[model samples]
Target: MTVTRFAPSPNGPLHLGHAFSAIVAHDRAARDGGEFLLRIEDIDGVRSRDELADEFRADLAWLDLEYRDVTPQSQRIERYRSAADDLLAMGLLYPCTCTRAEVASAAVAVGPDGPLYPGTCLRRGPTPGLDVAWRLDMEQAVDLAGPLEWTDERRGAQRATPAMFGDVVLWRKDAPASYHLAATLDDAADGVTCVTRGIDLFRATHVHRLLQHLLGLPVPVWHHHAVLVEADGRKLAKRRDAPALADRRRAGEDGRSVAAELRAALFDTGISLSDIINQQT
Candidate 1:
């Protein structure tokens, strides 16, 4: 059975991009006679708000995006920590103490998630209570995983190239687990068979593929659907101040209508839910 999921962080209200990704995943699962699950990625430390997570659930309910189960990353810290421990034991991780400004000043290249972290702390041994982050030793991890590839419904076969992002962090200084660690662990735990999200995350999948291989977890097919963007071509994101879906709902727009409009916008681009399941970007 194809188990798909729409995992959204609870740091902000839902927006059109969230709606689109949720609807696509929900529809694909329904069409394939599979299970659709909702996950609250609330592992952003204290920045995660329960009220916003509740609002996210309400927004999905309003859109009629039902699911079989709901899981929260905050509730699975132990699992993530366990995975990190396993990697650390394998000598595939190292402590990183580089600050953002320091990394930006030293980074040789910038990728989708901002400046790729330079390996400043690569040689630093894990210390006791130094307020350091844990980062995957990308070169070592890739060597351990060997040659690997993953499938994407939109982008076809993809070679795992985690080194492109440098040593990506598995644990953040302020969060229980970084998005990379928490998300990869949760997806495996939930038995997700198909991973669906906006195309902006397409690159991150390379790192995830490496994690899956290193952790000996099941690899799932991915679908990187087109992201909703503004007239200026900037993708809709909370940090960018994209209008919240709840605001539209409060303004008396019928929830279903708004959802339909979002769906229609995708359809107008010649991509339907079925196409998402079978086509490439």
Candidate 2:
């Protein structure tokens, strides 16, 4: 059985980007005759909200995006912490004391992996006495796994080289855990056999897959589709001008309409919203 998930953060309202991702997940799960799950990534307590999470759920429901279960990231901190501790105990992780500015100054931005480290801190890796963000010791971990290939629904198969995504952080210095750690742990715990999201995350998927390998978790199949874009040719995000799902609902646009718009805009499906809902089973 292919268990897929729609793991969206509850820090903001659902927008068009979210809609595209959500529909892809829901559709692929149905097409494959598998289970669809909703995982609420709300570990960032400073920005995450109960109301926003509810709104996300309502939006997915309105879109008729069905899932078998719902899991929240905040509810699984212990698991992520356990994973971090296990890495720490294995000498596979080190405390990174570098600040954002320090990292930006030290590392060069190569691609989606963010920075190609100059090994400034890796040379002084694994500070035993201090509490700092835990980073993976890539040198030791590389021999275990090499180039990994992921199959995409739209763009086809892609490979991630170690040169691109190396020694990514398992936890942030100020934060208890990072999104990468939390997400991979939850996927394993929830038995997600497949992952479907936007293509913008293909590179990030490499980081996630590397984490899964390091953490010794089952790697899931990936299907990344094109992200929905704004009129300005930018991706839609909650923090910006995109109206909240609540606002759209208040204005009387059904979930089906939004879902249809997403399909038409991104996937080029020219179908009436009402007809799309009627055709979906």
Candidate 3:
């Protein structure tokens, strides 16, 4: 049986990008007679809004995207902590104290997600009793996991090169777990057979594959669909003032018709998954 999930962070209102990804995951599961699940990735502490989560449910219902189980990351803190503790014991994790500004000032190169951390904090050693985020030592982790690979349903098999991401945070300073740690752990726990999301996250899979290997979790194939872009060729983001799905709903637009249009847009552009991964807005 195939199991897939549409996990969304409730930090803001759902937008077109969120709608496209959620619809794809829902349709994919239905086409394969698999179970579709919904996850609330609300681990960002105070930044996550409960009201936005309710709005998300309403948006799903408006689109008629039915999901079986709903899992909230906020309720799974202990699981992430345990996983981090094990990695710490294995010496694969280290404490990082660099602020965003500090990391950007010190970074030498830019990766898919902002500037690559320069590993400055890793050299300084741990500051006991001080609040610090736990980072996975990517070089050590890749070496320990050995050669790793994962399959993508749309893109075929590929080797995992976790070093491309540098040392990613497992436990965040403001949150119990980072997105990579929580999403990877929850996917395995929920028995997800296939992972589906926007192709913008294609690079992050390298870090996720390594984490799965280190934690001895059941690996699943991935399906990274193309992301929704704006007329200005920029990726739609809540922080960037993208219009909310609620705005459309409030205007009394036909939910089913909008969903159908989105489904058509998925392949109408003749854009490959690789193109989506490589094209930077």
Candidate 4:
């Protein structure tokens, strides 16, 4: 009964990186006799395009990676809102109006984005109108466990220090719910007991772990695989990414060769082109 999902943001075309993650997700589900689901993480309406969304579906279908159900995050904003409100009522959420500059100026800095919040807004008064992005109070999660631990099937146990990720955003200024909140809701609602995705998201495990504790939801067993890196050792991004299924489809390229290349790059497993050809079902 290991329900899993491949939740990709339909904001761009599927590339080699996406192919690795998708295969791992689908393969793990099949191995476990679990239900697999597809979730469209289209929360960013301004950037999410129908064509790109269609590309995600068409590409996955071409790879023969179909799911039992699909849930779009945009369609589930209310659920995120409700969850956020509940956290607010419990005095475990806060609204900080500090801009990127102001937060970065403080001695409490983590990365280029800003510092690990110095609790500047935590006790900054009556908890403002939430006019800006809202952050879940991390103090509630500090006692949950030591750092965060999850055994990625491909990479084994990987953990992140708590001090590294502090008070991550859950709701944006205009947008009600951000990816963190929506994704947490999706996993629980859809009964996702496990998650198999790219190792590129290893840092995301910290944010996701925090959300699970904050919302009182089950944290699934995570499996983050190594990504398909380019020859230059650079990671692929949706913007200007290559090996896009759309381009291949447009060029009238179909079938096995591409899958073989993808499989080879992903695991270094010398799968024959014929293996991919036969997998087309």
Candidate 5:
């Protein structure tokens, strides 16, 4: 059966952009009579508010999105750690103590996420007594995985190029797992057949494909839809303090009507859910 998930971090309240992404995933699974899963990606340590998770569920409920399963990253730390250990045993992971400021100052080239790490710790090794994060040895990992590819519903087949991000972190000193490791493992564990998320993360799929190849995980088809943006053209984000969905709910807006409006806005027509799925498939 087809499966899809809406994985949200609980650092802030749900916004319209998040609603759009969640609705897309929920409807995609519904269209195929498949399971829709919700995952709380709350591994950011103290920044992750426990209460926001409950709020996320309420918001989704308000939007009439029903998820059959839910997984919280906090409960899966051991799994992430085991995956890191396996990579380390395979000589694919190395310890790093580089700080963001240090990396930014040393980096010469930029990648999809931003200024790529310059591999200072990869060259120097972790400093003694300093807490260290684990980074993937991208060159070694890609060499071991060999040439790889993953498919996207919208973009078609894509050649995996994880090297563009250089040696990305897999485990963080402050958290059990970096997003690259945790999200990849969680999707495999949840049996997500189709990964539906925003297009901003489309590049990260290259790294995820390599992780799947290395870890012997099942690869999933992806659908990266265009992100909701503000009038200034900047994508809505929690850090930027995007308008919260809770505000609309408090103001007594009709949730289903709001959802329908979002669907029309995103698809650029009054397309039915089945029509959207048909066009993509």
Candidate 6:
């Protein structure tokens, strides 16, 4: 059976972009008679709000999106640690003590995510007492995994090239696991056959595919839908304080109608949600 998931971090409130993504994942599973799961990516202890998880559920309920199961990363910290230990044992992960400022100063080239880590820690070797983040040894890992590829529902086949992100972090100094490690593991653990998320993460898939190969995890087909953007083309982001779905719900707005409008805007109208609202007004 096909299984799809909508994994949302509870660091902020859900917005229209999140609504569209959730609907896409839920509808895809419903169409295929598959299970749709909701995973709360709340591992970031610093930023994650415990109350936001409940609000996420309420928001989804308002949208009428049903999920088969819900998994929270906080409950699976041991699993993440075990996976990281396995990678460390295999010599695929190494401890890095470089600060963001240090990396920025040394980095000469930029990668998909940003200024790549300049291998400062890898060259200096592990510092014994200093707290550290664990990074993947990309060159060595790519050699071990050999050639790899994953498919997207819309984009078709893609060759995996995880090196573009340069030795991405698997474990953080402050968090149990970095996104690449935890998300890949959770998808496999939940038996998700189709990963549905926004296109902005399309590049991150390369890193994920490599992790799947390294950890002997089940590979899932991906569908990276177009991100909902503002009139200026900037993606709707919580950091930018995008309008929250809860605000609409509290204001007596019809959630189903909002969802229907989003669906039409995404699949049929080829227009922005603001444009649809403008026309209706």
lDDT leader: 6
The TM-scores, one per candidate, come to: 0.91, 0.86, 0.92, 0.83, 0.93, 0.96
Collision pairs in model 3 = none
lDDT of 6 by residue, 21-94 (tens): 99999998999899989889998878999898888888889998888656699999999989999998999888
Worst 10-residue lDDT window, candidate 4: 268-277
What is the per-residue lDDT of model 4 for residues 1-281, given as tens digits with 9 covering 90 to 100? Answer: 87878888766777766776787787778887887788888877677776677777777777777677566887888889899898888776788787777767874557423576666777775456757778777767565444666555566776644446677777887676876678778888888888877666667776777667667788788887766655556666777556677776677666345555555555633333333334543
After superposition, candidate 3 runs with Cα above 4 Å error: 268-281
CA RMSD per model (angstroms): 4.8, 4.3, 4.4, 4.5, 4.9, 1.7
> What lDDT score is found at residue 210 in candidate 5?
96
Q: Please give, for residues 1-281, the per-residue lDDT of candidate 3 as tens digits.
A: 88889888888999878888999899888898988898999888888998888798888888888887566888999999999999999998899888999999999998777899999978999684458888888888988999999998888998998898888888888888888999999999999999998888988888899999999999999999988776656778899877788988898876776677777678624333233324321
Query: Across residues 1-281, which tens digit of lDDT does each residue of candidate 5 receive?
Result: 99999999989999888898998999889999999999999999899999998888888999998896566999999999899899999988888887888889999999987889988878887653448888899999999999999999988999998999999988888888989999999999999999999888999999999999989999999998877776556778899887788987887877787777777767522224333223333
True lDDT of residue 90, candidate 2:
74
Indicate whether candidate 1 or candidate 2 has the larger lDDT: 1
Model 4: residues with Cα > 4 Å off, grouped in runs: 111-114, 144-151, 155-161, 268-281
Residues 42-118, model 1: lDDT tens digits: 87777788898778877888888888656688778888888999999999888887889999999999876789887
Order of candidate numbers by TM-score, starting with the best: 6, 5, 3, 1, 2, 4
What lDDT score belongs to each candidate, Candidate 1 first? 0.82, 0.72, 0.85, 0.70, 0.86, 0.88
C-alpha-based local distance difference test score of model 6: 0.88
Ordered list by lDDT, greatest first: 6, 5, 3, 1, 2, 4
Off by over 4 Å in 6: 128-130, 267-273
- Model 1 clash tally? 1
